[model samples]
Target: MDADRISKLPDHVIHHILSFLPTIDAVWTSLLSRHWRRMWYYVPTLEFSQFGNKDVEIFYNFVDDCLKHRMMGMHHNTMSVITRFNLNTVYRGRRSKVKLDRWLSFIAQPHLQKLVLNMFEYEPVRRRHYCLPEVVLNLASLTVLKLVFVELEACYPVSLPSLEYLYLGHVQMEDEILHTLLLGCPSLEELYIKDCDKLKSLRVSSSCLQFLDLSGNWETFTIKVEAINLQSFAFSNTAWKKPCSCRFDLASCKKIENLSLHGVSFYPDEDFASFISGLPLLESLALDQCDLIDIRNQHLKFLDVKTVRYKDRDQANWDEEDWDKVDWDEVDWDRIEISIDAPNLDSFKCYTKNLLVRFLMNSPNLSETFIHVGYCAETETRRREREREWIIVLIDVLFLVLLVELLMFPQVFRRNCRSPLPNVNKLKVEMGGYDEDGVRDALLWLAPSAETISIELEPF
Candidate 1:
């Protein structure tokens, strides 16, 4: 009955509603009314990214016509109306490259605030890539730049005056080119570098950068960041056996509050302690498969360590001779030690392999404690041999203490805290393995306070 109520809305409200719909769908709404036809021109964001199985030429023409019509609708004064332009498609050959270049050149206006160009090769049999045009750097008004599967070279100088956020994933660029790009974006506040194989080192000294994420490049030799205003930082390397020892030099980032490291081994080991000590404002820290000889932080509230053992060829860098020198299976668990000192820590999560753990300070603020401890051996015989060893008993005792601390308010397990089997608190134990029932039965005696226990087969 009130059909015109939808169309009677203000033009600005209509345009805002249309902005969420796909650009093609928004254009189809033109048939609704004369008022709706004109509203499409004011929908500031244009996204053209549907290229599933359609003919490449048809897709290219569709994008071309859409841009042309949007440009024609705008008078000379509306040249800078389009603020966001996103084009994601599978680029095949030189023909796709030409169309992409034309689109980039068309959108290189003074008011373009955000630009995303994600071109991937859908046909795995015939992979093709596009060399990013130098004109993209000339977008002085652009505040965010996200590029995926594009190749960049230092042939052209970089210039992005207002850019604050930059994300480059699966991009191919040399170390010098990446450095030049970082240096050019003076106002950049957030930077992310992922799966860029050519980048060997990341050295960011931007005072304005507030967030930084660098990961997925296994060959990266060093990471040295000195952003004084940085609030969060994350670094990851999935590969286990690396060619060179990974070094993270974040000492100058004094204002950092949150930090994460995954699969990144620390060299000179003591550097891990110094790194945490320097970040006085840190509130959250996560370490995944990273070396943790010592973690001493007074301001930390949440800490998570996922030290799961993963044995795969992908984790191996066979080309490096150093990888063959040490056998991971034969690593001495007794020698592996972790010392933690956090007074105000609220939550602690530890999923570790065989390692000696010692909490130097009683975390008075801790409210939650989760510990998953086990010794993974190469074979069933070796696992049984290890289960009979003295460490297994110690591990059971440690688990009981960890659960007791969880139930009690003030931690009873402080420095020099030790107990064997005797416990008092509500505890739960869950095990995942083929012999889960057997494993649970063996460990239940050590945790008499355990009120709940569950066992399931290992998913993997």
Candidate 2:
């Protein structure tokens, strides 16, 4: 006789196994054995996904069937106090909203902890965005809440005391609503907001915030973050509004250990040097498509600097038409210089187009180094336009970017000085420009004693 080994397992064990399966699939397992029927109902988590269901009513009915107090009718409540619920569904009309509201109310048990609602509006009938049902924010047991394409209702003061992590993506939230919403999450440790609409000014004064990531949609926005315990913060508004606007202000989050800034420039007049000096606890820093004059830090361990990250909103490759749009005469390509002074730095990475940068101090303890030079055409269209030869173009690009010079540490550039990264254990170099054997050989000169060397070439 075949062994029914899975069904022979204990009730809790079966429930645990079933928790990983989809709610519908878990429910289907009930038919495998008579005893297993009741066990699936006790699983602590439920996940339902209707990937653009053509029949919205059918999906709603399925969820209602599964969550409806079972045979106990309206009075007894769910069989088990579900801890987590994830619903990725399409919002069709009032009926879908009504069903979602009902389900939210049904699952608002005190034991519920994590709630994820990825509701996308069906374009044809999306007359208005879905306003979040107020009951969701009142869950005191909630810890991780992710709301996408949902609007927070400004009905009253919402409270989620136990919330530790929150993600708001494409969420329609007003300034006052956000302030009040954050005020309620006193224990929130990590927060991520991307494409949040209608936000003019954001004041993050949370004492418990340790990590914050503001991804984009900062056309005209001012952010003031004053947190005591924040460690890692990343802000990327790739849609550059003004060349040198001081819209972002970190209220000296003194304990921050890691920082990343993209699509922002704070140069000489803006006093960016003083801004870096203010953060005494910063250990690792990353600057992308940003203008920096100097980086003087004592306790710094890791540094990453990139000039041209994306081509037309992070596109992979650039076409001929886009290349001709640049007015090369206006941009001071060589006037700007970046000098770094971090003695304890361990790892360094530089990805650039063509710019000059300097490292004021030596990195004796450096173990890892990475360099990526990229995205120029083969035609030499920008350099000489008429000269179809590649050798002359390669020479011009090689001599321009200073970060590569600092890494390669060739004898020609510096007369008396030795290589700063002599003890590097691993070296990685990526060339997006036309690859010649000389380019690879040149990058490997500094790290002569490196244990491992990786060279990647993506030639245009």
Candidate 3:
């Protein structure tokens, strides 16, 4: 009774739909009907993933046979252009390299716009990086290329004039090879390189580049970038290092709008406040597990900071060899005294177990503020009380411990926030191990004008 309306779609539409399925599944669709018998031979995209197959040779054969059929179809004038191809498998031996080379060479055509080669092999005896085949030397038409766990066969430069996006993860390539490869891509816009431990020098000089993300435990290196039009940059590394290894010079990227960093230690020469002030167009900033001494900016609108204290970190999984390299007395990691001065800031968030963030002036335009503090006992309380007004930030940090400290003596809270927060309309309080009467007095002293106050606590 059904006329198979969907199957009557145009050839190009059917090919587009089949592009999302694995090449094997697309080929198996030939069994659906006589009309779909040879449809897969013309699909523009092919994806082969050797995930569930236990027999490596059988999987290799399937890929080889599939490509052979495609080549034959092209000879017969039945196949069209292939714009994208994704192949994920393992490289076990010389035969694997030969097969990979054959496949890459066949697909390295002017019409191939995107190519992804992800071969992740897990062997514990001795980790080794696979060599890239020679055919990848020139893929002029590729717009996007992603390679993981593969190294260039040689230190020769390759050409990719049309490339706009490139990602290399766990890729073993010399600093010279990487520098030359970046130079070859004149149109590159976004580049990401991560977890490639073999690199020591990072040099990216692109006029049209917009975004760059680099993450790894870079022990010591010289990093240089000359991207005039860059808008966003991100760098992340593991924490607990006293002094950062790499020194940076980002004076060329003046157009940056958003920045995120983690586990980066500022050296004596690199002033964080000066760097923050230099970015006039910057609007958003986020720092995680990074040193924070002082920050002063006028145009910022959003700020978020998350810091870690030495007592809060767990060193159970850290490599013993690496742990021995750290000097515990380099600096008092427990003393986290941070100062922030942002007048136009609209949103602020601070999450920490033991750290004090001092804001010089109140955030007049602040619409949202969230502060969750934990594990600050008598020692931390005394250090904070003796060091800071501790009253200026009472309006921002509503943690139970700090509140109890400031609320224990209600006069300090009243004098500092002389006027309750007039903008606070809804308030919620959770109390434990404190008298309800003291909690009530603190709320009245802090936000007496709050229209609605919700309290959830156990009677002390």
For TM-score, the strongest prediction is 3
Across 1-460, the per-residue lDDT of candidate 2 in tens digits comes to 9988987888788888988998989989878767876676788888999975577678888888888633232244355668899999877668778888888988888989999998888773553567888889999999999998888878877889999999998888888888889999999999999878577788887999999998765645678888899999888875643332436677669888998887676533556656776778888999886755478777788989877432233232345576666554333334334566666777878786653333344555556666565654434445443122222333333433323433344557545644434567897776564444655565556455788888776756
Ranking by TM-score: 3, 1, 2
> At residue 450, what lDDT does model 3 achieve?
83
lDDT of 1 at 2: 54
Per-candidate TM-scores read 0.77, 0.76, 0.78
Q: lDDT per prediction? A: 0.73, 0.72, 0.74
Poorest stretch of ten by lDDT in candidate 3: 400-409
- What TM-score does model 2 achieve against the real structure? 0.76
Q: Would you give me the overall lDDT of model 3?
A: 0.74
* Best of the two (1, 3) by lDDT: 3
After superposition on all C-alphas, the RMSD of every candidate to the true structure, in Å, is 9.5, 9.8, 8.9
Which tens-of-lDDT digit does each residue in 1-460 have in candidate 1?
6568878788778778887887888889988867676678888889887666377777778888988887787764363278898888997878888888888888888889999988887664654568999999978899999999888888999999899999999898888888898889999999998888777877888989999987784854687888889999988875645533578778888888899888776676547787798899999999876756478888999888876333443443345555456465554444344466788888878776554454444566677777676644345665545545434545543453443333222233422433334453544444333455445554455455666655444464
lDDT for model 1 comes to: 0.73
Give the winner by lDDT: 1 or 2. 1
Residue ranges of candidate 1 with Cα displaced over 4 Å = 76-80, 122-128, 240-244, 309-336, 353-365, 373-460
